[model samples]
Target: MRAVTANALCAGQTRPGSGGRTRVLRLLLTLCALTALFAPATPARAADTTPAQAADTAPPSQAAYFADRLRENPVYVTDQLPREVPRATAPDFARIAKKTGVPTYVLVLPMQSSTGGKELLGAVHDRLGRDGLYVLIEGTDVAQATAYGVRAPADAAATVALYELPYDAGPLRSFERFAEVIAQGGEKAADRAEAARAKSEDDEPAEMYIGPSDRSNQSLLTGTLLTGVPLLIMLSAGYVRRRRRRSGAERRLPRWVVPGTAALTATAIALTAPVVFDQTRSSAARTPSPADLSARVERVAAGLKQDPVYADPESPRVLDARQVDRLHDRIRDFRRSDGGGPVYVSLVPQTPESESAGDPDLFAAAVHAKVGVDGVYVVADPADGTIDVYNHGLRLDSNHLFLDLPDSVAYGDSKADRADDHLLGERLDALMTFLDETPRTDRPGSESAPAPAPRAADEHTLPPLFATDFWPGLFVGAFLALLLSGIAAGLTWIVGALLRRRSATPQSPASAPASASASVSASNLRRTAHAELTSLIGEFTEPSNDEPDDHGEHGRAWDCLDAAMLLVEGDPGRTRERDTDPATLVTVIVLARAGRAALAGEATEQCCGVNPLHGPAVGRRHVRVSREGNRRRMLPVCDPCRDTAVAEPGGIPDRLLKLPGLESGGSRLPYYEATDGPLSAVPDGIARLIDKVRETAGVH
Candidate 1:
């Protein structure tokens, strides 16, 4: 049959649609035959039996008939049976019993493949001897299987099965049901047994239970409550001190220095106090044993082992002792690690328990030993009953480390009266002391030890660059250079301006006589010149009668006189030399005055008698001059004669007007012969001279 099945499977692969149909037909035929072989028989006599007979007589026997068929068939007995079925003997049962701690009631059903008919009977004997509840049964029997909702052929291999019993009972109840079902020979028999068991136990309740006192809970409370008070006090004190310091700084210090110095001092006091106190506390605390640490390690290991995260088959978690050792080693290093340098450390309680203890000593010590440095600190984890170690490195003057231990360690508790308040204060004090005193080289021995020699100075040093001397000097030098440069530039500009002004201004000539004065003579020649010029030019007409003739001869004469007066005004540049040309100016003035006197109907002889060309007359009288070789010879004339000459209608002779060298036509005189010429001739000469003067003055 196997060879035919293999050949047909091969044929199905070789041929497409036809072979697949043939294979399906073959499968159907095989299924039908197996179904027929395992089919249950209907009892013919059971239907015919009367209710009274059914109750009295045993049910018609399908089991016996099936047993007869199985015994009759050699193939069923040999090929269908297991080569080595499990036994219900003492040793075999004991082995299974040790592996699973369940009682025999639960064990017997799963051990049914060894003995076919006598298995249950033998199991009952073994279990009864051991004081167990029941024996094994045909776990796959029709009635037994149907009760548990499982189905298998009578000759099928035995298999273990589980079921959720009624009333939420466990595996023990299911096993008891299996055993009772087979013994009582009915589906409802196991239910009766379960009911009886439940009833027997119902009167008594399970024992009331209590668990052990929590050591971690006590530790937590002690740690927190003890530390909280001191921590609060210390923080409060520090805060008050800072306030005092700030007030002091404001009152005492200069405006510029207040901010920096006050901040620095406050921060220094705050940060340093806690670290120093922590150090002292750490030294004071008791040290725990290595055995205690080992136990803790084991507990942690056990927790990790039970967690599915670590036990999962696909991805397992791993840990090593070295990693733990390194962590402790780092902490130990921190306990000893310190310097009077900028960096400092502080310890604060991190949980209510830690704060309650009023001491960080134990925690600090553990962290110190673990980290090997004084900078290491311990804080508590409130969520998990564990202490956290911290390694803090901050500038020595930082307020960040001046934490209130109670506040810091009490999770989120902000209350002042927490149990761990005192611990916070104490820890702060210890931390401050530690920070103040601990040396730089004193760290964990396990870590790379600091070199013996102090650190070498590099090629560059920051100190000099930021030194007090350097900045002040640099600033002073820069300021002086800038100030002096500005001053010098300004001075140079002023000096240059002065020199330019001096060079541009005109200077008096060095050769000029300083004390020399020139003589000026007053004369009436200008009047005569004015009169002549006005008669020749005629009178000017005005556009309006109210408007005077501003452009007339008199106006012209006034303007000229005013211009001359301006030249004589006190100008710094004007000098006596410019105004002292007496001969020409006096002649012009005298002629102008003479002409004005003539026009005013004054005696012509009196006005014309004053000649600026001649000196003052002898005896306070007038002097007459006659032309002689281009020079004038003076003749003594009486005052009446001068007056008569001025009063006459034609005061001067016309021949006198034609005086030699004074006439408009050319004329000359002999020096010897003209010594004492006529008065008329001299008068005419004077008039002509005056007319010549007026013409030269640009009057007419």
Candidate 2:
């Protein structure tokens, strides 16, 4: 069998009722998407910290190296817990460095310091040239872990995407989960590197699927739909029955159209939503191989870390001079709140004698060495896309800086592009936002007091687009939306099936008019008419509790109304002008029902003409269905009858009382009110009564 082409599908949609189906499908698809967007989510919760401890406040030159992992000896381990470094967890740090080929460092402490982590990480990152990942493990109330780094192999990067660390599950159970990830990720990186090396040597032109062309395959499908469908419609014209009406059948599209359209639209979205909203559009930083870039960054960092390079270079900046003062002011404010950090900005040239060419971390080191580790330093080669940020003496870190980072600068997803997220000016603004957002801790002497974790209003928030949970969340949300849509579609189908089955059964002729008149109840008409009469005569009679059976409890309310209606219809004041005029009687009955705004639909047949009780000359029976808001109601347009109601309270026709539901209800409610009074908001049965009465009595 041959497969149907896309053109066939498009042509199928051009059939009758397609436009309406398309609109409904679009609406359902939109609703499904919106439902997915609001799916329940769990936000990243910040870790709790103990009070700031007495930190190692010594100068960088006098500091001692903790391990051979880094030559700059930037790692800091606090002994406040007697043995803060877990024997098992510490090995994983060394393992990460070995796998990634960049120097790794750790800061194991019992509490956070008044100084921010960003300033410290910046200083280390500058000296190390973003060598490897930085791990900070705090064991206050519970063990908490936070990881930071510049770049790693794709495999290694995937492993370290930790929002918060599991309690010491790695190496002696100190962030053990993070360690396992590193090991798994490291093996992947090694294999990937080997594969890439093998692929590079192969250079052969390969067979292709399709080359670039002026004519697209997609266009052929479109063109076929545009021309083929009309031809088919024209050819099939003779097959259509030429009779005025076929078997007296009405032309309806059928019940399946609405649900079928909704299902198709939802399916299309399910197929396409992932492509549109699944992943962010970005490219990785310019690099040859991941390993090569790491090597270059480390080499540059070594030169910048040397004391001579840092001290001698009073770095010139490429920043606009006018903005320098504002940056300086913001940095000073940063130091005041963040417990002081070395801050400086430098622009390096790419000559062999200076920061090296092809890479930019060297320029960052040169600036950091000169400025020392007591402040913030930014090193950039004006030709490159990123500026390295480093800080010393300050206690903050870069995690809090991403959000504060200015959006004015064109940035990239650094994991892929290796480009800067912010320009120098924007970087300056981010530094300011960081200080504003970081929690300010009091000086170290307040040890006796409970250390309150720094309260940041918008501190450390992950952008939903880049959120760790975003991808998983999308699948979960889509599943829920599809589930709900399916349930609703099923319920609608079941109801439609039941209705179609009932409609298919033949309706009896005797029951047709009775079913049509079901809109107005006999009791409703009788009670309302009797009330109107009693109001007119200024007398009232209440029904008793005696067990009486007319229709049930409500029937008692209309018994008096039944008698009153009989009296009025039987003796409508015998006279030629009033008695001979059936139009006047009908006009009055219509006025009563219309004035009360009671109308749903008229009886199928002319009840007044067929019945022995009705006046002569009433011929046709036109119906008024229940007013489905803004729909034109079926009102009797006889001018002769309308004039009778227009005359006075005496002009109301007594014939209205004989109608099914209107009998007990007199024309009084509509009687006193003017013909032009606002349409009444009576019950549905009452509203239908007027149209039924008018259509029945005023048949022309």
Candidate 3:
């Protein structure tokens, strides 16, 4: 047999130009429909009832308008099997809804799959418009129960899950128990909420009305500004004063530091100033009392019926024409009352232009004004999934009828972001339950009694960021701050290192010939000193394979050589001018090597190659042009000569002219230049010839 699927059957029926195969499928479908008509209900929930469970070609689409659904008992039941929805159940569903104030819906049928059932549920909710706990059934136990536009006190799914009915009992028995739980549970929950709220409010004194006052505000502003401004100024001024008091502190904070500090401080004051002022003054005295509020409700009542729905320009219903239509249909069901005057409903979204607590109150009053009796006003923000309800003319202190907006009506796995029809329906159910618990006692003059003053805004300040339990926001903020601090510290270190390197390495202005030349000369001088020191140190450390000097430090006196080298390197500070400059350090090493040679009874050559002790030689650093003291010089100075030189200061000694690295000044101040003699002073008679040559050449 060529089997035909349910979708194929539906398509064939909807499309035109049927072929022979279509005709055959239609005939087969008709026969199956007839068989279903005579057949008993599908097998129990335990069995996999197929063939019999084939999709119903004739889907009982419950997508008609809500008004149409209301024309009946607000309950509709249809099945794939031609059995009727027990005539007794439909009217009872209506009676219970009217009596208990909880809307009820029931469906009995064979489902093709969960997907199809969910679609059917959605369709039914849209068509009916009234929120109710709906139980879906097939053979025995409840298949599923969903609250559509209604949150029943007893969770439908949970109740069904806990049912204890036996298999032998008909499914109706279990369903009856489920409905009872819904109606009763809803009533009890409402009672509990009302009692709790009343108990909490009983201890409070009548609230006072406090309003914002400008005189107080101006005074506070002036006082804080006076106090805070001076403190900030003092803080900044103190920094300058301290800097000045310090012997060598910088004259000013970096330009950015002062401005940044001011900005940070100003921001803190700006943030806290308002809050501090607000806390000091009391505004409870200015708040409206119940009587005052009741009068206010009457004032707005004139415009109540003018617009049934005071929709904001950005209202969800305005944006989606179809949704408005759906809402209208659902409201129509509630409009049909049992003589206590028909109720009107208002739907308003939270928008900037809309009344803030229209929030929930404005719409409820508006609904009551229009209907002139019981009414419900719902304020919702679809954007954030919040729903608040306000009821007018409820029999009890209508304050309890008001519901705080819940953050989410529908929840799904992580990906979900908005409420679904089921959640909306459940919310509506909660509204119905509250009304059922206590129908209007006072007519409310177009509104519910003074709602337990919507929690004073400031009374419930935002919770601290660091809570005793946990705060994910604080955790995330701290992590980010630490990460940024680490990055900033790393960047600071790198930048400082670069700056030090650049400064220590003297810059040669590539554009300036004089600066560049001077830089080159200094570099060459350091290099030469380094080369000389290295050679001197190596001369002692490394042995000559050929011979030993008079000092008996043979080709190899490894121990003495090591000792001399260690002393020079470790105490280079002995002769270096700065102890750190490379050139001065090299000089220190050379002096150490020379001093050691002198101690070994070996002839030591002076850096300047002049020794007065060797007769007429420039001799020691003390009397030579180097002009160093005895302790600081590599060679000793005789007391008599030092005294004579100090007492009779001559310009320059002829014998002290061949200092290494010295220059002659032709004209510029103290200018000195290298002479033609070997870097050492002229030997015994050699100086006489150099002098004669200088005199011949007319040199000074």
Candidate 4:
């Protein structure tokens, strides 16, 4: 019967695309599905359950199975079993276990229940029936070790590794650290644990402490931005408005324009003032009543009972994220050690509501009374980075807590210079280490230590970063913004009134000197050029009642005029010296002159070589110039400029328009020859002079 069944299975596997083989596979699958539906739950089915439920359901059966596998190979990893630890982790476990010397078995599996520790180790040892060390690792978080009939201090070594290392130290590192402790075996291992803990504490970077200088700098920056930024923006807006009005037909705004803008700016500042500044009750007036203090203590005690670290959410954040984590880690380490009771830490701002007495020790005692537990109670005032410790009932040598404060807390200068959030945590961590190492007496109160001296307040007038006045700086900023805005609006109104009066009173050409107009500042040159351009626009755009003799002449004149208008109109207000402003102004002058000449039935000529702003050329002459390789060419020259060019050595004209050099004052070539301005593309009079040279020479 066995031979017939084996031959039939072999025939199904060997035949390709056979109907019999397909039917046999389908029948086997159907049988599996039916068996799973009707039969009792198996190990495969139990794998889908939660770790806690699976742990509680069948520990003995699972242990027996794993023990048998361990007997074959100490590092047992199964594909049939579900585990958080990767299959690749088996080699690493095998290597670590081999080095331990003692008969060691490490089981890396997914067992997240509380009893997955010692209980599971016990069951596995019972089944394996070996006098050896057994380790159970749960995912990458928990690790438990047990030695049956062996000399390893499994519990003590595990505890030292668990709490001494950082909270985020993974399972492998924990196991490695645990193995090291086991190898040492006794009191030397305990000393090694203390050294590791001390090193970890020393290695952590201290949190940044905001000091008096930081507060002052912050205030100065905030004030300047709030006041200066708005003032500059408003002034720029006014300048832009004035420029636009001067450039266009409309030169004056409505009477309400300036006043209304000022009013709106003031209203905005008023609306934002409350939100910008701190609106909480003044710290000076924060003395809480007896009822409030008791209520606060009761709430703190309740929180401390659940978790050792109790920080009031309503208070200012004194303990940052890292400080809080370190505090919790230190508490856990202390709890796991012998001769130490529960530790309750309260981090609160020094307020009447939070503290009954002004002192931290008194406040801690009050909290301890409500807690109704015999343990160490710690009260910290994070506002000034101060703390006090109290011992209610712990079987240690000392009833009084002796704290060796850090230099920052001990000295006045360092304390004033640096105010750290980690100060409280550091002090608490030191206290915990001291409590753990201190030898216990036979009975409570058998030994008493001297009380440490009270810590002195730093002799600095500048308030800590937390307690700085937020309202004063904002108030000053709003006042300045309002004052400056009003002054600006008043000045605008005054200037407008003066200009309106001047327009009403007409001035003849005799009253306004040509010299006065010629001596205009560089800033006002754009406005002067704008006025001349406007007149030129009117001449070309406005229709003439008298019909012209030549229609083509008028058309040509209008074309030149249009080109000049486009040049002047391009990107107004970008009047940088190196920008297109100089080119645009000169081009407008040259084009306007050509239009006037075209209208008069005269041939248009190139602008003078000395200055394009000198209008049309009288004639052309060959003037040797070193800028053009000392070559002489027929160049346009105005009458006065022509005479000046003749006077200069080599007849080289000193051109009026010169662009800035790469590093020094001005370029070696004239502005038009440089081919670096907006007018280079446009066929203006000066540009036409260098057209062939620029195109053939590749100057552009």
Question: What is candidate 3's lDDT per residue for 567-670, written digit by digit as tens?
Answer: 34444223233233332332223333343343344433333322221212234434433322222223322333444446643312322222223233211111
Over 4 Å off, model 2: 1-272, 275-279, 283-289, 299-528, 531-700
Report the lDDT tens digits of candidate 1 across residue range 158-249. 11112223322322333333443444433344455455456545543221221112222333333332333333334434444444342221
Reference-based TM-score of each model? 0.14, 0.21, 0.23, 0.25
lDDT of 1 at 314: 9
Better of 3 and 4 by lDDT: 4
Full-model lDDT for every candidate: 0.31, 0.35, 0.40, 0.55
Candidate 3 lDDT trough over 10 residues, lowest sum: 510-519
Model 4 segments more than 4 A misplaced: 1-60, 78-83, 112-116, 163-170, 197-700
Query: For all candidates, what are the clash counts?
Result: 117, 51, 37, 0
Give the top-scoring candidate (lDDT). Answer: 4
The model with the greater lDDT, 1 or 4, is 4
